[model samples]
Target: MNEQSLNLDSQKVDETFFTVKLPEQVGLSDQLWHLSKLYTLGIALSYTYVHTPFKCPRSYNVGYFETVIEKSKSILNKFTSINSSSTDKLIEFIGLDKHELNISDQQFELCNIVEINIDEILKDDKINSTSDLKKCIEYFGLYSKEKIYSFVTKGIYKFESKIEQIVRSANLDDSTIKKLKLPEKYWKAKEKFSGKFSIDNSKVKITLHIRKGDRTCINLNGKLVSVFASSIKVIDSTDYRDELKQSLMDTTKAYNLIQEIFNKYGEEYFSVQVLSDGYQRTFFTIIWAMVRGKIKLNLNDLKQLHKTKKALSKEFNDFLRFSNISLVVGESKQNLFQSIHAIVCADILIITSGGFAYWVHNFFRKSNQPSLIINLNSCDNKVVNKISKFL
Candidate 1:
């Protein structure tokens, strides 16, 4: 049947109905970001749902978009029919057995399906530059010509000027948005948190999130950290890699910088927290620099050193022992949600440039605290400023 046969207005159906199929392997934060955008678009257009290969983990405790769609069963059954083998593979990939499949009747099959390439959508000139919702919808072919009468009757064309406001003030009454705003478990766990480091609520916690690994563009360079060292006066040259490396390795400089920050912020009211991959030598070196003279050797520290002895480089293993600091060691081993929670709770935050950091600064952070952002990506300062305004 066609859209005209649907009799949308009499049935109280919105002008259009569609399901957006999200590509697989997108990161968690990125998936949420896209979903947030789609949520706004869905409200502006008609009933919308998302079909994603990845399910939101139970730890997040948020319902996926499909759970809220009125006719999710119909949508999924049709989707499965269209891409049968691929759907089976995806179900298997997520470890869902055949018994867990929830396919239902296609009695309410009135929706169109759109495979959304997030990158392409973002790159679309109409979407990127204009605030015209209808124009965007037409550009993306997200409507049924058979439902032309409903579009006109529903005054969809009249919403062009108010698109920006509609998008900005979109009612985020969904469970996903609510759960993200106040993650109860994340905060509850903070009381008895037992991670690589403990949260000290007594002091002004300053979290430094240094992005490393495959994302090299936004990696926190040694030179940037050396700027805090008052005793080190290395000339600013085009390439200060050698000088920066030496300065970081120099424990005295790290101690001097830490002392300066402690004195300035009040030793009793200041604490430093770091979130990054633990396997990097720079991570060990930086930790050693901060705690070298402050913390005395302990038995637990010895045990931790032995545990991570083989994982760390010889020099960094020695550094950890000399500094009396212990760290959870592995590639990308840090818990992202925990780090995000720490960032939100921090009185002051130091972050490197990236989409993840930008989103945290914009949507998740509720406090109007001071932040020192290292822009390594030559990113638009205006974009950063705009994100900060939202916080």
Candidate 2:
């Protein structure tokens, strides 16, 4: 465990990173955001590709590209650090003419698997920094007295804005939607507009983003008291209200489960918000929390090398980068565990577990979306046990 994210809070003598029981549900939207963002976070473990076109035998050209790729062990993760000599050798084997050779550069996608490491960052004192919280969290973990002020000043606003942005985009009452001023995009397919602040006139539905007042203590009353006073709140119909309520209830229950796990286990847990546009609001928030020492990587990121099927692994990275995310690409981790930590803390989940790490991640997926789970490490027994539950 990164000493930066976690420390011996109850250390009468010493503290250890044993898997302890947790009571509070550590369900934060950020966990899923980080998970989903792993496919999008732009922090690439970068190396230049040296293309060597292999013009195989006419018979070999008939072979599926997959077969040739597999023989070279060109899986998503086995990234070759290409150099000029390597490229030259590849060209020779491919039988390409030097005069005619023209190849474009391409990037090997990052593997979906991640390792979340809080202890490592903590040792180095790399907290998310908007202000001086970096220095404070370095000296103290998430709950340090010095960090408390910074948390309230910097962290709360940062975290609340994330949740608010997500809420504003979801279908909500016209009045509430207008007030929040969230990001919005028109859906040409639906002919109906959907955004952070949304309204469903056809469905007679309106959704309002209600922040977790008890947990965050945001600028709720300070601003809302005046805003709500000026705005005329709309009365919602029973059916429409029920649907939104159910959505919130279900999400809350899941979140509470994680919180319960955290309070009991004494582990770092957080939920990140998911946006309709596949934007990683939660992913950004954790990086924000890391600055404040509110969240850090867990111990699991260091424990194992998560495995996955090669194709699914490659596709996962491709989908996100293709989606046009610019800030970060893939979860900010190397190896399986670090990515896992970033995802869990970031709160965005991809919904598929067809890979090696799927076992531990099965329960974390949304039940309705079967395809979201990415199967990378498909053979492990523990990974299988977790995946089988949904099946």
Candidate 3:
């Protein structure tokens, strides 16, 4: 059958149809963000239904995109398609799955499917900012601010639940289950590849999220030195060193930060879990310098020593030997989500000044759960004091 024969004839169809294509490929987290944006846009536009042609290449990981997409489709069904009687059924009835529609799709000339330039739509004066793709969604004009918020919130919850399920499925052993059940008691690396370490539990649980990769850094004599873009630096004097001190909280500073939290919330109430690209080798390079005593343990140096594989692995492991503080380092997307989920559920949460940190901070804030977001981007003690008031 020809593509034109599938979709309804534009002149006769009662409902308007439009679609927003997802990026060709992206990380699972990024993909979910896009889907949420698309959902928001569809609800705003009064479009018949929003469609996504999300399919991964055979070479890439399969479950990452497909699993989240399935969960999103389920959530969309709740607000949109109720039964086979819905528009999805209409599309199927007309035999349209085989054809992929784009700007030049012949189907657009005869049917309701039409090319929509998001840029043109976003140029409207009503949209105040185009900084975020989600910001532009409000211009669709299909729903009010209240309705859009409700739908997007629902979508986020659905995706979060799916991520939790993925983590649960990956963790089937007793050791992993024990850690998840009482994370505070078993503050060790969750992934089997990481060497085991354990310590006593505390009264409070704080999840730390560190985002690395693509951030500008200097390779000094084979050692990695993280340089924050916002901080002022000088080639001579202690400016660069001092700036580094403020930008990242090293092991001692991290310990000190936790102690401060302990002082406010009570020593027995606080424990820590780290949600990051734990085993990512490149991110851990700075830890090499930390272990060698070339640099202090700071935010950029954060990551479970056991999860990483570096030439100085033994030295890093030895450094962890005497440490009283222990944390559960996230291994996968599901594991990371579980930590984030716990952070959202916990009475107290702490985050740094990284992009992912801000992302998590925003999540809790929108959920109406006020959290302690320490801007590690700057070392000013006032920032700590500001966080204390939140606690």
RMSD (Å) of each candidate, 1 decimal: 14.7, 26.7, 15.9
For residues 285-364, what per-residue lDDT tens digits would candidate 2 score against the true structure? 32334445654433432121121112212322322322222112222112122233223222223222122123223323
The all-Cα superposition gives candidate 1 an RMSD in Å to the true structure of: 14.7
User: TM-score for every candidate vs. truth?
Assistant: 0.44, 0.16, 0.44
lDDT of 1 by residue, 233-348 (tens): 22335466664454333333333333445544445555555554433433333345445553233454445544443443332233232222222223332365456656666655
The numbered model that scores best in TM-score is: 1
Q: Model 1, residue 291: what's the lDDT?
A: 56
lDDT string for model 3 (269-349, tens) is 445554444333233334443555656644432543233334222222322332333444424434544554444444444
RMSD of 2: 26.7
